[model samples]
Target: MTETGAAGASESPRPRDSATVMLLRSVAEPAGSGFEVYLLRRASSMAFAPGAHAFPGGGVDRRDVELAPGWTGPSPQVWAQRLGVDTATARALVCAAVRETFEESGVLLAGPSTRELVADTRDEAWERDRRALLDRSLSLAELLARRGLVLRSDLLCPWSRWITPRGQPRRFDTRFFAAALPAGQQARDVGGEADRAAWYAPAAALSAWKRGELPMLPPTMISLRQLAEYTAVTEVLAAHRDLTPIEPELDRVDGRERVLLPDGTTHPLR
Candidate 1:
């Protein structure tokens, strides 16, 4: 496998733990049309995957696992089993997914109680807290405690794990999770690292990618490819998935850089 950097000179960077959320929702479109998935385009000035369409996520913060907010659904121990990690790490990963999703997309996978979800987060106070969460002034557990809310951990389904190719300036060992867009909640352009945010039917997004309009990393495209197969959010959430970790192998075939995987898949470098 090719271990040379993109420039064929630099050494590989160590991968950092991160988590991403695939927010899905059903559209009025017909069957086989597939469900919609939210995506954000990173600002061009960013250091990693700039200008690439991606899901909302980021590196795990040490404080993420410290939150003791009320939680419903599967416990951290259960997540550890599903994510193939220890309980502490699993707790952090799940919290990171929820926190990053809210920070980037303004969608909260939380509620006042397990039976209901927060309908609107457009209040000035909510924005203040969101910013505090992003700026590290507040931990999610602390924020939830102040609001008497609980994280609806049941909303998330562990989907996949993807490690960035070995030779890159920035690499992430990212866990991908899927969640249905909460009812009464809508996504908006929150603008930070990402300049634009929108939702697209999975098939449409794939078509855009093929047309060279929606550029994305291999993992994003692969996740979309999988999502394009399902017609509804329920279908995706209910389907059994193999959550094995996948760290794409880099190789130079016929003098062209490519990403190879054990599943007999290959994607040429852009």
Candidate 2:
């Protein structure tokens, strides 16, 4: 939540619409929690949250708002009701969630039909398509249409929404989503914006952040805290969430500026 070496600006930039997916899987040997979440360490050279551990996501692309790709599972109308957006925007957000997760994690959430998932995506042809998606040369719609696949929107569960605190150099109004890693799909270190990728039990990740071994933004930290309560991925997917947007505010605490979250916790604003 804190931005170092930059003075606060008087006017805040409008937040960009973005989507983030927290990919999870059940762990056989529990380490403080029964499930582990996938996280990527942003390359230090990135402008935003450099070196921080985050989920696989990015800003919604213009193509995401284009004609909808083949889709199954929950309809966009239902998603609009759940995500608090119009049907079109809801579809775009869901498309972005699936596209970003696949681009960053090598795990596709789409399949030939509603009841199936792409078992493996490590083939040479798949990698070529993935690279095209990453570089903006391919659209998710076109990709799905060509391959006779449909996006499995039901694979994703709405978690929460967060807005970057005002006055930062960049900001995003991001919808957080939770999804179980699909069976037979493996998440690998497909580096691009991230320097490394790994899975961590929710509690263990928080412990690492506390020990200064992992740095995270408030949203990621808070989401992990929530996830740590569940013993199974199914429990997380079945849980209902209140999706009111959380935007941190600036407050002066004990002579130092800090970011005040809706829960009243304060993070030092460096």
TM-score of each prediction: 0.92, 0.94
What is candidate 1's local distance difference test score? 0.87
**Candidate 2 segments whose C-alpha is farther than 4 A from its true place:** 1-10, 252-257
lDDT of 1 by residue, 70-98 (tens): 77779989989999999989888988999
In the range 51-94, model 2's lDDT, one tens digit per residue, is: 98999999999999986899999999999999999998999999
- For candidate 1, the per-residue lDDT at 265 reads 74
Collision count of model 1 = 0
The C-alpha stretches of model 1 lying farther than 4 A from their native spots are 1-11, 31-34, 253-256
Query: What TM-score would you give candidate 1 relative to the actual structure?
Result: 0.92
lDDT of each: 0.87, 0.90
Q: Report the Cα lDDT for residue 236, model 1.
A: 92
